[model samples]
Target: MSDQLVMIIDGMPHTGWKEASIARSIERGPHNFSLQLSEIWNTEKQVNRRAIEQGMSLQAYLNDDLFMSGYINELAPSYDANNHTISIRGSSRLGDLVDCSTTGKAFAGQSLLQISQSLCAPFGITVHVDASAKKAANQIFNKSKRLDLGEPIWEFLEELARVRAVLLTSNANGDLIITRAGTGYADVALALGQNIKTASGNFSGRELFSQYTVSGQQSNEPSVKLESVDTVLPIATVNGSGRYRPFAVAADDDMDVAGCKTRAEWQRNVNQGRSESVVYTVTGWRQTPDGRIWAPNERVIVSDPYQGLLNAERLIVETRLMLNERGRNTELRVMPKNAFDLIPEVESAASEGFIR
Candidate 1:
């Protein structure tokens, strides 16, 4: 048999072995073949690889591949209708995952956390689950019977501990949603589906992990350029006057003379620059006597650089989760906080395209 005979061991497939060392899809000789893994392997527990092989599909098997070969990473590249998720490539989030697992488990890596990277590393990958399908797969796996030949599905399920996925979903209208999905069932689903093919690449965490620094390719970029300045109204004056007036060319030199919008803006720009925005509103702006404007008491409610993106992630994850639980009956509505105002021009539901 050719050493390249692709075989499914447990739930994942391997490209055979040479010199007793398993060959990486990417590093296997000069043939130039590579492995693409699935996004479902991160949070799920494991058992015997052989058991997963009988029923698992090529994609899940790929998940197993990247995992065994040390390549699995966070959930495969995902997107929303607007097309954006979290930019957690180099964030401490992955470190936090490692921290949590190490603290709780007995061994250094009792979870069998496999990793692979020629570049930046990652922690976890969340997925969207199909509730009904998972339930069915679970029932099927639990039964002490066989399919085609006589192998117990539970043996496979036993190898796969129950798991939940961090998934992304969308409404009928195409608004993205987010949340958790079932796992052992995800394993079953993969067994049925073909390999997850990507023109970009396959779903391998090791491959994904190396993406950030692959060939000196900078993963982080300035997609949106935003600038902010801040200033606070002084509570006291040099000469001791609480009732201060705006800077007058002829009168008070009291203003910081920062030649800026507000003291806060000056501090932000000159002090701690590069802060990203989020959902909170910054207020406390005042107009100067010279018609200049300034904001003093305004600060972000959510200062996380990635908070804006994470908000979108949370929404999509929850939405997927709801649909997985409710199926076709699942209905999602993204009512903007100011929805009524956004469409004030439309006076009726009929005018807004409602069937009623």
Candidate 2:
């Protein structure tokens, strides 16, 4: 057996999917052990070999799993030999696998290395002496960047210190008023907008229109529609590819410039011109002079940096965030790069049990 010690780094178990349907594979974390090798092999070779031979990812195989594993993986680690206190100044990993974070500290007089070796032994893990925490951190960092899937995503919500409004329901009474945390002002502005209800059960990202489904009894199954929108640029996007940052929008319905009365009326009233709010349903993108509608790849925003002039093809993969979505944050929210890598779902065929 290798002279290295191995210990099971306990971590939390997680499988990212709804329990009702659509089951995804379970993600596993790796084992963490405290090691202290004699001044012999280089740290670089040891860490690299551990990652490759074990066939584990840093975010997968080590760091993250250790942290998330709670009782097991997140165990307080120590190292020593001969039952003496070897004051460990610090601990770190080598090579590039640094997605998870580790904590270290300067130690006083003690024999920590001996204990580390003893504990690391019998478990099949080896402990090596290394001085650089940066190297180990790098190992976790580099590996996490390249991995396709990762830990669950959580969103942090802050208090609405500004005056805000909660939309009760779109059940027609429209007089829905909700009490908010903030006393007034900012919260008030977030209150009732011109038209916050839609035919669908979704709110308006553009801040002017609400979407209500109107497909008769089949309203639960949404029908994606687009109306024309001229003039002002849309802050959110219709692209389903969830790669875009704060501006990532996936609303199925929206109002347009023609019916965009709030801003227009404000401007008209300021100029003392008698005009109605100029808002309309968001019409589909205009046809190109070549007699074809814009392709999904055509850039909706020609000036944007990340999505500048990109086409609509990516919309197929956007996360359907918001409205009655469950959880604090929508688990459906996927990173843009990952969304495109998805494979189309296969159809299931009816197969009776095979008769022997």
Candidate 3:
């Protein structure tokens, strides 16, 4: 059976798109979509120019499953001698956080969940904090948390996420998800000459470095005594196997020595993983052998001899679903599973039954 793509605008469902694309990423960011419709008409054979408008609430669905909840941001209608088309573009609710600045209010010992709720409540965005992230958030802050004036909410949250070693992602329904990475797994595997229609690899080392140093001030006093030393700034370093290139970064203001080390290691791992990346295009908008819809942030097993990968598990970083004259296709960008720095989700007995 063919999958259906429906967009509900102002409580009305429309499915007459001629070309469309939906892009989503595992990163805590916005999912975007664009649709082109050739002269939307009503049952009375009249053009429905009022069907779509900017700022209208929109919900996108695939096979009755809600995929995106957002607002229409752009509307372009064009008419030629014989062809008339309407192009609509929008992003998931997270787009609001990305575009708008935080209130710059300071949080005094507030948990991440509380702070997130305060920031998202204004935009009607919901928050779902994972158990692990909640635990991390509960840690006592050495100093009061404050947002920079006119700083985008997304950027603030991303900085916090890095310091806490968690991930900021969103659900299909557009709710903000503060969680760890690799918590989910894909049921189907991608194999060469099988499910993947096309595969390409990017093995660039421009971003890789031989060493990474993160320097910052630690909040706590040093446990060990250094002879005749009053204080020392905490600094952490990680070494890589690239050209003698060196990289250095400043740790977050709230980070300690341990956090600095974690950040440095994260930088190394993520860049190394990104240095050797792969993109796979598979026919259809879902995985083969199971027909499950493609999703980001899920780990999947891959076997591609041409890429020198054999049963290697990888993480799905992004997914782009496209429909055009050629047909429907799902393009996936994947990297090594260790590219992420968040803690892995622990499995429960009940989850083992369905988790692959």
Candidate 4:
């Protein structure tokens, strides 16, 4: 493989970038990329100010393999004593959903996919329902759904997604993808003193708790209330540890007892999964042997004795593909597969036996 980073903007291929960075994360909202060009070393041959503008579509590839697609949102040009540089920055198509507000229109008896399609269509974004989220997509909201004026589109969608126990992400084609965690496995592995150039582990217990209690509101019926309790509030709890470290939160929206329990379990599992993380910096953007591009939401086997990880399988939560004077490197952040899964059933079902 050539391992060259090529970016296409407005149907034109551009290369020889002095520096480039593309960061993506399943936990984050959108994938973003930055490119820097300078005239100091005649690296500005591909610089086309007219073609690089806000809202211009862009695609990035590695070894001619597509990885990122989005629009350019930033353009900066600077001149120093001996160099003239241009910096370009942008995010995946989902960034529009994150930055813009909803239409304040109410929805009734609509499914998740329907709502997503309606909202995203205005921005030229398409909705892709992954098999993992098919059930969630088909789930219909029977009640009257109202959106507050000026409410951010992504925030509203995230609330709906949380209720369904699924996630909203974007693919290389810049289309919104409804999916679950750990959807696939990487073709290669990362091990200490092997493919990984540097490794670091972060183990913290600050966000974790021994117990999580999720509370939510039900109906306003007097029959639902207890002895003198004016209103009825559904509450569910999940244990995290033996200690008394308890954390409580309110539901994102109105839900049932089962939903509350799922929310609590999600909080506990995500915290426990995030409590420990391993970050690895590899030499190139692709796997050493298989040549597959490093991507988020994929599980990979990790064998690093320093972090007590012995051929353990973990989810790739985030990745940063970087190319600078030092050369191309990929930084991967992995955590427990269950961190992003909402319910235990989902987590258990997605788990596969360790890779050989």
lDDT of each: 0.20, 0.19, 0.74, 0.76
- The candidate scoring highest on lDDT is 4
List CA RMSD, all candidates.
28.2, 26.3, 9.5, 9.2
By descending lDDT, how would the candidates be arranged?
4, 3, 1, 2
Candidate 3: count the clashes.
0
Q: Weakest 10 consecutive residues, lDDT, candidate 1? A: 314-323
What are the per-residue Cα lDDT tens digits for candidate 4 across 1-356?
Answer: 45778888999888879999999888766899999977653335533333566678899988678988999999998775557787999999899999998558787788779989999998898999889889888888656555668888887787677657787888887889988986688988888888889988887767766556777666632111111111211011222234356587865355567767766766766776877798999998887543778899999999999887999999999999999988889999999897787752221111111011
Tens digits of lDDT, candidate 2, 1-356:
11111223222222221211110101111212222212222334432111111322212111111211111112122223322111111111211111322232222221223322332243333444223211221121111111113311100000010101111110011111111111111110001122111111121233322221112112343233222132321322332222232211222223243223322332222222111111111111112222221111111211112222222211111111111123211111111121122111111111111011
| Model 2 spans with C-alpha error above 4 angstroms | 1-51, 54-57, 60-213, 218-227, 231-356
Superposed Cα deviation of residue 68, candidate 4 (Å): 1.0
Model 3 Cα lDDT, one tens digit per residue, 99-209: 898547777776667778889998988999777577875554444666777888887777566556778877777788887766678878999988889999987767756
Query: After best superposition, candidate 4 residue 296: deviation in angstroms?
Result: 0.5
TM-score of 4: 0.82
